[model samples]
Target: MDSTPGVTIDLTVADQDSKRFGSAPSPIKIGAVRMHGWQVHPISVASDQFDGADAYLVKFNYELGTTPDTPEMNWFELGVELREGVVVDAIPHHTQPTQTSVSYIVNDHLNLVPATNGVTPAAHLPATGETIHVFGVGSSGVRWQYWATSDTGVRWGSRVAWLVTLVDQETTHLDLTTIVRFDQRPTLDWNVLPAVTPADLRIELPTATNPRAEVTTQPANGTTVALLPSSPRVFISYTHDNNAHKQLVRDFANLLIKCGLDVRLDQFASPARKDWFLWANDNIDNADFVIIIASPKCLAVGEGKIDRNEHPGMHCELGIMRDRLQGNRRLWEQKLLPVVLPGESLSNIPVFLQPQAMDRYEIDELTEDALGDLLAAIHHGTEDNSRSPVVLMATSARRALADS
Candidate 1:
């Protein structure tokens, strides 16, 4: 074991880990993880996209070698495996919180490592002859895989990072914040969970906030668990800028509803007595399809419109759509529909929505092509990618775990 502070002791040679990882690298590359740390830093990042959810996300970052001399070569990769929620919230040591989390760059790719040292480094796991016993802090491990740049020549490692939301979870101490390195993985049992490195580093911790699990499930903070009817529902999102244009959206909703769709419209879903914001969000959260009648006024309200703004209701609907479909290409393809109404330039569409295929129809010369496409797309039910078909990590669950 290297006596250097924060250095991980190298264990078991090439053959085993190579086979475990399905690679046959040399002994030098397999063991003796040179350097990693929970060294903290603040970064500007969007708060966990699904806000006000119970799940918390934390990032673990570290540097390679002791200096900039560490050789990060091609096909050389660094990844991390940890129980979800093990990375509870933390304000990176310095600077104000700006949706920050730990992060680093190994070679050119973003890489992940452990946050706390209480978790035993693989080198410290029980050896073959010892009584192997280990338990998990999370229901499953979260793995972030990274690969080296084969094309570029060897480069020194960059400080790695994870910009994650704060989370809270029940925790157990394996001899409270102990750092252990073992030769092999211990046979794990529930009674004794795996250990973690203590928060030994002297980075000032920020004031702990409420656990993400306790987050509010409202339209503003955001939640994905929909609240709409099971029927294929469509949400008419538009602006009331022009009287005739507003009627067009109303007519559009009526058309979809007449075709056996449960269409939710502003004037229809929101009675004057009802909270339009909440009503719009309900459909945005639950509706099967969202047809944005892309217009300058509608697009302006998407983000430029805020809480007290005239188009706050429209902003809520469109903003929620952006959050829900952030990285989900599958759902974006199914759940969101943008139609260019007459006299509205494509520039009216938000930058995020611009790349999407839009259905074009003029209010004065309305055609069936755009409307027909919208109908067909929404009729095909939204695909639930929530189920992890394999043992792989479920992003939804991980996301919740992330912010929790």
Candidate 2:
């Protein structure tokens, strides 16, 4: 005897070509009145030179048995879980619904962005315990796996699930699709679902036989593929002007972390007891790039005008930096970067660094775009080819003083 309320949910997979996706299972009732259906689709895109499958479309037609009084009753979520060796290349944004009876909203708390060519979206890789929400009307835990490899053609698997909230307080969470295997290849033309071409969709026969040989590579006209570079190590040197200023610096560091950079800050290491001088020396020595936050107080310290007893950390760091600059002028000139934050002026930069003559980054706002120049310098040396006169003069003067 079925005591659950009578509700109808017709699930079907449309626009699925037989070559890319296997037979889709019929809609099955999981718990109470919950219904689910699944299909295996490829996660990779194909091109003329290489044989791979492009993105596929799965049409979901959801209809509730009865309209409820509260708005919460209309909540539902669509999620995807990737198996081992599978990584999410791109995902379409669901901020705006295609067609829905009631008003729908996309939860961007995870900051998931639509996949665009040459642009890396946020929340693409979920940490070991992190949950990423691809599309949903309400919130729920969505788990997925991402692994990196150098193989061109790799076996990728994903499970799509749907969760519905019933008015009777009974929630239904079931796998909408089975584990679909596809050859994951690197492609620049990542088209979102519904816009993908049918000709671009085709699965390779005789999938990888050995489990260890998950991905098989096929050379495409001798095309060279480059792996993503490791995260750059950045050390920030800033003055403790005020609480607000400290907070601002902290926020800036966090944003850099979100952008996939290894940022080292004193604030992040304050929890453990440490020798301040050693900490400063180690970070400045090991960092690939040192970001000096330009401010009035920092200028005073750099110019040797500030009292030696104040801001011991800044004083020690500046001393080490000056020594390094004097030891290897050209190398230090490229490694040490001067940065002016919002509401700060270029004149605040230390004179020895040559604020007016050398390249200094101005961050108008704390965003990826605002940090573009700084990031560029850190990744690639300053575009300017001319040598800084101030640096040459300073080095000459130091040599003369040493001789005397």
Candidate 3:
């Protein structure tokens, strides 16, 4: 039960097909009770193996006390290994042998019982010499086991193959599994998130090569259900000189919400706080996107500014947002769509953001036509693939608006 300690796994990748190749052996660690031990063994060994020929196989062998009428069900616990620079690719394959079989039932009192077996069939399990994808670690090593709250609870996993390219296979594979989960689970609704920077988007664990499978560190404790609420996204960022435009911005954000887009906005700062900058910085650090209400008042710095210990100016938030989005050029572009509300001019726009045009909407000049165009752009920004293209178009529009 305490197989992988402190490790978190995305339940969606359990039982999925994973593939990788290397001459060096990626060691795997496993744990189990008496007579039942789980093992993850690689099938393809190569001074150098052919492309796609390298594979890892998962084996679950356990003894169950057999009894007449009431048979024991096999309870399995497996483990997965990983290392740095390893690229896990999904391979869709489902062919596992059945696990449930007629065996003696071990009663709680360790007495012989003739009761109906409750174990479901585990047919089509991983064959010998097959590459198996791992999800996460349990108590001891990275144990891979079928986990459901109860039989009535649903099980979710992908049968996709994963390709792992290790930078150095000689170091030994870390006794860990990659954590994965779907944006929408337990709910029938299908939610899709843009492929943001994997590193910045989430936290990763360290690798280990020891035979004992010592748990080095605990994975991020944020659960899939917790990190991903039923909402579409998470937002928390700055309150700036655009305070006057708050009403209009909220109106636009409300429209986005009506269209089912999750918006995170903090309308009023706590009147009790003196150091508002630090608090605002922390907010921007966690948000999926930071919306900058670009205006002369927002961008222009007034005279006599000092002790700038930190500031929550629109530009300040933009700088922090940019840092968080350093690598993910695509998601950064998609999530951070600039809105040129009425009275805002693009004359002093920053340099880095100049490449991509901003989504220019003269909210002041709001006719149904302008609103419609703006809505269309916002709609496009909702899709996963729309970041780059949408940012490009928005940038161009902003440029045109500036020129005109």
Candidate 4:
């Protein structure tokens, strides 16, 4: 099945929840698959923060009937800024009805009977959504369904929502059933990924304003699995050099974003009233990778050549990074990425990082080869090859000593 095209949602920021209930006053897009009508009950969880809870408990109504078992889930995104340098995700919600859910037997045919890839119980399925197929076990037996959704064209994530009527008010009997056997579905060891930015919301599709639904983007071609892998959090380190160098770094960061990485550059960090030095330290600790842009100005601080009172933010950050690398040899090899700009002398590498293996951008542009290498290094898994650089250096030293 062809993938469903996505609709970008515009999110408005409100200082307070006015309890208004028309068109979703919040920048959040909710409700997918309009049956008859459903209620949006605002339920408080441990924390309303995106990390812990949702804006509300939106219960989709009606049973999976003639409408099409291949249902489209709703895409949601709230643009309200909770704080500086922090981002939230536009989450697509779809699950089995609370009152009724049944397990379906796994069938390997047509990506059905998923022997390995885990299956999620979906109420709104597509007759043909994506290339993969969905099967739900019913009281009688199991059956397959096709589903599809659209892409929002957003670099990170796609956001949209749908609506339906109240099924209870309808005269026809609603059927809520499922066959769910967790162990028989896909494996749970899939990678988890962070959410991306939503697409522009101005685009609209001509459909009955009341009954509509959105679906999650299938993971890949020929297979449908959970969207679990997250982009690594990369902290970009650079000096407050001339606009040219700064622009270069900014462009580099944008390229990383395009390549599916959560870049934490200082400009985007927006330290606000926070102590800039302290902010750098905290950002470094939280980041999965720290990229040090090698330039004359950037190297000055790392080399401790600049006076403490003059401007030590970068210097201080370098100190913190070096200490982190020294303390955790394992993290140093994996987390620290030393990048040099075009025309930068080899000696200009940060004094603390000179001994470390590094990569340089050959041209002024973000080359595919350079980007690929950086990405590979940043997102490398901790498999049998998880040996740190220190370990490799030590082993090489032993070999040399024995030869001598």
Query: How well does each candidate superpose onto the true structure, as a TM-score?
Result: 0.35, 0.43, 0.31, 0.46
In candidate 1, stretches whose alpha carbon ends up further than 4 angstroms from where it belongs are 1-231, 270-272, 303-308, 327-329, 356-364, 367-370, 381-404
lDDT of 1 by residue, 1-404 (tens): 11225545332223222322334334322233334444222222234532322232333444333222223222122333333233222212112213233332211001122234343221111112111111221223222222223244223343332322223333321111222221111122211111112222222222244211211211212222221122365777887777567656655654453344555665432111345557777877777777788787776676474344676567677777777878686767567777776566666776666534544433433545556655566655644444432112234335545553
After best superposition, candidate 3 residue 403: deviation in angstroms? 50
Per-residue lDDT tens digits of candidate 4, residues 284-394? 998878888888877777777777665466777788988998999776756777787665555666766753454443334576566766677766742334454323423
Best by TM-score: 4
- lDDT at position 151, candidate 1: 48
Candidate 1 vs. true structure, TM-score: 0.35
Candidate 2 lDDT for residue 219: 24
How accurate locally is residue 382 in candidate 2, as Cα lDDT from 0 to 100? 31
Query: Cα lDDT for residue 95, model 2?
Result: 17
Q: Could you tell me the TM-score of candidate 4?
A: 0.46
Judging by lDDT, tell me the better candidate of 3 and 4: 4
Please list the C-alpha lDDT of all candidates, in the order they appear: 0.40, 0.44, 0.33, 0.39
Backbone clash total, candidate 1: 37
Global CA lDDT computed for model 3: 0.33
How far residue 213's Cα lies from its native spot in candidate 4, in Å, is: 14
Poorest 10 consecutive residues of model 1 by lDDT? 122-131
Q: Which ten residues in a row have the lowest lDDT in candidate 4?
A: 178-187
